[model samples]
Target: MQTINLLLAGFQSAFELAAFITVVVGLLVGVIAGALPGISFVNAMAMALPFTYAMGATQAMLFLGGIYVGGVFGGSISAIMINVPGTPASLPSTWDGYAMTRKGQVKRALTIAVTASATGGLVSALMLTFLSAPFASFAMRFSQPEFFAATVLGLVSVIAIAKDKPIITLISLLIGMAIGTVGVDPLYGQARFSFGIPEVESGIRFVVVMIGLFAIGEVVDLVASNRDLRPKKTDGKPERVRLRDILAVKGAILRGTGIGCMIGVIPGAGATPGAVIAYGVEKQINPRGAEFGTGVEAGLAAPEAAKNATTGAAMVPLLTLGIPGSAATAIMLAAMMLQGVNPGPLLFIMDPSMVYTIFAAMIIANVLMIGAGFGVAQMFSTLMRTPPAILAAFIVVLSLIGAYGVRNNIFDVYVCLVFGVLGWAMKRVGFPSAPLVLGVILGPLAERYFLTAVANSRQDYSVFFTRPISATILFIAFVFVLWSLWPTLKSRIGRQPA
Candidate 1:
């Protein structure tokens, strides 16, 4: 009871006038950055970090945390309206969100998005506030063997629920694992895939690869699609959406939140896998989920909840183990470090107030998003009213600016244009771009673990399976891989079902 009382009191303490003002400004900045294609949450935080130098740690945390939460929810607005996801996390929202737009229920879809996002974000924040210490304690007790086991469990579990083609998913996972090997081996200094290039020795920059696969690849893929093949003019009217329909997607909301929270616990795995797994689970559990491509609010609700829930859950890694989850969290972690705030177990003991403040700010941002998001989306909706010529030029310039802002480098700009074309072409051939992004993000982690396990066993192949946790995780991975290959193996023997 005392713990409960203290937590509620802590929430109240967040009402300082200064914190309130920071929340307001953060909301506005986050709204705009989130709606702008290619200007992801990470970039927004990085861009704003310079200004935060003047503020105290608590004050700066309020602004950064507020914007982080708001930006995530903000992506849903443009995703639903434009058929273009403002952030990678918004991809699943586009499945039904844009369909709802075509059904002329844009406003209603937006409302459902807001409601689900708020619910998920709020719940996750509360969970993080009260449960973080315990979770952090648990994470601290994990040894390398346990860590390896956990990592293996995640990959195997994720593969089980990935896209329709498990075989394809494994192939993608392996490709990622292989890419992870490109850098210097953690156990020994020898490089495997550097090809003797100095630039490659530091290894492929994870951020650069993400920028390429997600940001660049998406643009290329979208542009390659023949404009004529786009969905017809069934865009929904603002008023067509009903609260009843939003309420009906409750199952998706609940399922998505659970999945998002679970996945977010993994350091380096955040909303991307959460969204994909949520979408996949919704397909199995909800009747409407199977009808997703045909257009359904349930589909939108599931991904919206999953993606936004991850916003708060991703903080768990950063706060607990000083490890970042998603790329956005990576940038946030860096920003905090720049301000001289080290995030670790000691941070919890030494700066409880500052930690509580961030927790409070997270909740406040979700609340602010409800009102700020509506206005931002409505104003930006005027984009639909703009002529194609004007919009095209605007998109081009905006994309260029976004690419260059990553490092003010022209090389990235070329990468974006090239990937944009590639992405467009890939979609034409029925290939999904997400696997490519996942391949890039997970590539490194998989490689490090594999090499570490091998070295610990003195290059023995069985060392990875020696520990109880590691063995369990490896067994699961083996099962998952074989399960994915089952049908293919059967088909080769002429035993496939019709």
Candidate 2:
């Protein structure tokens, strides 16, 4: 009943012409920014944040949120067409997506990507609007122990997702945590790891790190591969998705949406994780799963569906409990705070109207995203046939421009160069690139939240266990960690006879 009222109220409210226009601009900008390699949603939002200072709070939020949603699917464009995922969330998409591209079905992949994103996002947003309020009321009961446990659980769950080995992911996370120490301490003003460099005192900016790791690193990978033409097995012209294709893979959509929404509802499991797990789970459950890596529709549908769904589910914590599930949501939180909107229990009571505005804008942005995604995908799809020289040159220019656009700093460009080289080196040595980027993004949040929990705990170790909700969340995190490690643990204990 409450949800219906909110929905109806949201629809009746008149969005200012300018505010609605901001959403349109944001959707367009997001699609372009996302389609570009190395310019993930974070940079897109940060890049556009300053421009919003002159706009009204609602408009600015809608614009930025639109970008945030649109950008994730954007990465799949290059991931499918060029064998390069434009964003981290698109990584799982790369396996089947790139395979489909090789078979000259890049358009098919793009269509599924865009559609799944819309479906997942809509489901998640609907969940957020209907369920966040109750969750917010529940979250207010959190104490120091519960909060601390929740933090531990979040960090552990991420590490647990490392299927081959959890230790490697944990080590990567620790390294990220260590790098996070370079900035000023939150509780104390003293510098921790400046290493005699003043710029290090503020620590490395997340935007700088992301650009270097994702964008520049990808450049190194692309150049090193140096392959000009993709192998063609299907008709040379790309396949446009028929409604039949969607119907055939209906199960993938449902499963991915369920998985994404579930993971997204949690405080730390972001869209990427949802996508990864959904991809893995989909392949495992399907009878033809073994053929997934060999290239199939289900493979493409799983991650695409989950990643889009996650964008919505991530909002559940952010709007309801004043906690953000993913880095993008965290940024959304920051953006909202900047605009003078505090998201908590009070938010629902104080401005039901604004809540409705956000709800309306999300649904509308999604509708716009479909049109925008297809338009951009087609334009890029045409360019996909361009000469390799031209393609590389375009990527290089976009990379450099995106790097410089953040702060207009030459140093960031230098950092991009250094990381580009580092990425190439790592690829040569066969280290997985995805985990490193994940560590870098999630590291600071894990550390900051943990530290906050500890400082607030004030030596009360029992606080973590005493609180039922926190304890339960922590238990789940531990379960996931143990589950991930069990096979390895058993193998270590008993070696098979050769």
Candidate 3:
């Protein structure tokens, strides 16, 4: 009953003019960004982060929440229309969705994709609303040790998701953690990697690192490759979607949503894995599995549902434990911190109104995404017609400005530029940047929690293992790592000569 009342109050707050408009604007920005090849919604979020400073904490979350929800679905627009995935999570869409496009069923594919995405997101948002309070209650028992363990679990889960190339991912993650340690030590306040540079002592802001890595690198690549962004016209007449079309794939949508919700809450397994796994699972279980890649509606629906479903599920750990699961959520975390708001169990207790308002905004965003998706799909060609050079220049300027805006410091701009070049190089080499960004965001939190736990326990490291919750979480991390690597191990062993 209390939860019901709180949610009602939340809806009331979310319905306010400013919050409603913010969500609409953010949804538009996200859809446009996600539909454009090479310019992802994550990049759009990073660039938009600077603009959030003027918003209230609630409004900022509403804005970003709208973007997060809308962007996840927007990627499929391009994938279906042009055989190009605007975001990595949209990769599966290019297979079945583009197949549908080639068959002149592009409209049918889009209807299924958007409908499934909105439904999955709606279910996930409802889950976030009901499940978060209970999770927050559970999290109230967590101390520093448990928090540290949870952070570790988040870090290792990144490896699990990128299991195909764990070594490279780990190296990238470690490099990010090393970068995270460049400023004053969290506990001791002593600087280690400053190298006598005063600005360096304050540490590199993750926001700057994010913009440098995601935005600048992507822009440079688009410019250098000179890839044409326009969507090719399809030959088929647009098919009208009926309610029967949606009913036919209901099972796939539900299964994908379930899988996405489960994977999303794991802290590091994000939408990309969720989508891929859904596609894989749907292929195995659906009766038409053998026909998956040839414009099967179920195939397109499942991954689309899974990817958008992840948006709300990924927020579970962030709101309950303050652990960010992906780059997008990490940026949201940065926004919260910048607004002087700390997320976690106490956030629920201290600010239920704000928490529930975010929940309400998420629900509203998912509902509104249908309209936003169609609007952008219509304008996609016009958006693509903009010159790549002009777009690249605009992104570079925005990124540098975002970096400089961190502390209003020019040195941060230089740092951003340097990392931008590094990011471009890393991209060229096929190194994963997501894990590195996750490491930077989570590393400092882990350090802080670990040091505090040890210090509170008289410097005894065993305190982590002594506690049941912490130990259990660590054990889960261990098992998760083994589970993630087992396939590779098995394949390698099978390949060995007798």
Candidate 4:
């Protein structure tokens, strides 16, 4: 009853004209920014940080919360339609969502994606409203060792996507980890593999690398294949969403939401890992696991749901314990500090109204995201109607701009071009690049966490196994790896002569 009253009060405050408008505007900006390659929602939030100064505390949180919800889903727009993930979390979407686009089911793909995303985010928001306190306690239990174990789980889970090519996938992932190591040593603060170049010492930005690998390689493929992206005519009838289609993937959505909520509360494990882990889990469980990359609806829906579901759950640590779980939440923390608000258990008692109001805004944003997603998706899909050369040119220009904008350095542009060529070449040879990308994304986090855990534990290697949580997470990763590789092992056994 108390929770209900607090949430009701929250809804009342969020519905006020100023707050509502702020949310709507933020939602639109986030969706557009996320759909554009190179300009992620994190950058959008950073750019919008100045504008929040003009608004009251609650309104400011409302605006950024709306963007947080919308941006998580926005990346899927490009991933599904163009095979370029606007964010790392959307990489799994490209495997299945883009496959659907290739099969001329863009409308169906978008409908499923938006529906799953809204459902996941809505559930996450509700959980945030009611379970914040208990979940905060759970999140607090995670230390550096456990965090390192979670990162290892994320890295090992990539095996599910290897498709019987585990050796090659492992090699690709290792190469990515190598790339991630080029900047500075996390523990020593010394640069390695920079060859004394200033830009190399600054490290390669993953966003620039991501844009080059997916966007540039995709445009090259588009120009080379001469594939037409215009909507296909099907006896003068447009493909529509079926009730059965959503029903078919209901299990995936629920599972993804649960996984996302669990992962989000872990400080360093953000939406990217949540989405990828969801995809890997769905592949292992779904009956059509072998057909994951061929446009399976469950494949697309699970990750879409998982990524957006992380939005509200990601905020729990920030709101309850004054800990910023991810970069996005860190910005929110800055906004709160700028407003003279300190978030902690005391904030709930002292400023319950503001806290609950932000909760209400998250719910509203997720609900509103459905309409925003379709509106933006419709606009992006029209780009498919353009000639291949023009479309390719547009993608390349956007890719280049995104690369250069990473740090406003010409050297980053050169790195992106080098990666672009490598991506295209890898694509030509049918080598998996996603694992390499994952390696780059998680390797640094794993290294930082592992080093901190070890250093803090007096260089004790047994610290991981000594802790219950860390040991449990590492054990799970081990089981997951064996489970993922079981099919190949069984297949080889079947082919052996007696």
Q: How far is candidate 1 from the true structure (C-alpha RMSD, Å)?
A: 4.2
Per-residue lDDT of model 4, residues 395-494, tens digit only: 8898888888877898888888888888888999989999999999998999999999999999999999999999999999999999999989999999
Q: Give the least accurate 10-residue stretch of model 1, judged by summed lDDT.
A: 226-235
User: Could you give the candidate ranking by lDDT, starting with the highest?
Assistant: 4, 3, 2, 1
**1 or 2, greater by lDDT:** 2
Query: Best candidate, lDDT-wise?
Result: 4
| Per-prediction TM-score to the true structure, in the order listed | 0.81, 0.80, 0.65, 0.98
Superposed Cα deviation of residue 20, candidate 1 (Å) = 1.1
lDDT at residue 222 of model 2 (Cα atoms): 67
Query: Model 3's lDDT to the true fold?
Result: 0.80
Could you tell me the lDDT of residue 432 within candidate 2? 47
- Model 1: per-residue Cα lDDT over 313-404, one tens digit each: 88887887798867777877877887899998888778777777788888888887888888888887777677644555566677777767
List the candidates ranked by TM-score, beginning with the highest: 4, 1, 2, 3
Better of 2 and 3 by lDDT: 3
Clashing pairs in 4: none
RMSD each, Å:
4.2, 4.2, 6.9, 1.1
* Cand. 1 Cα-lDDT: 0.69
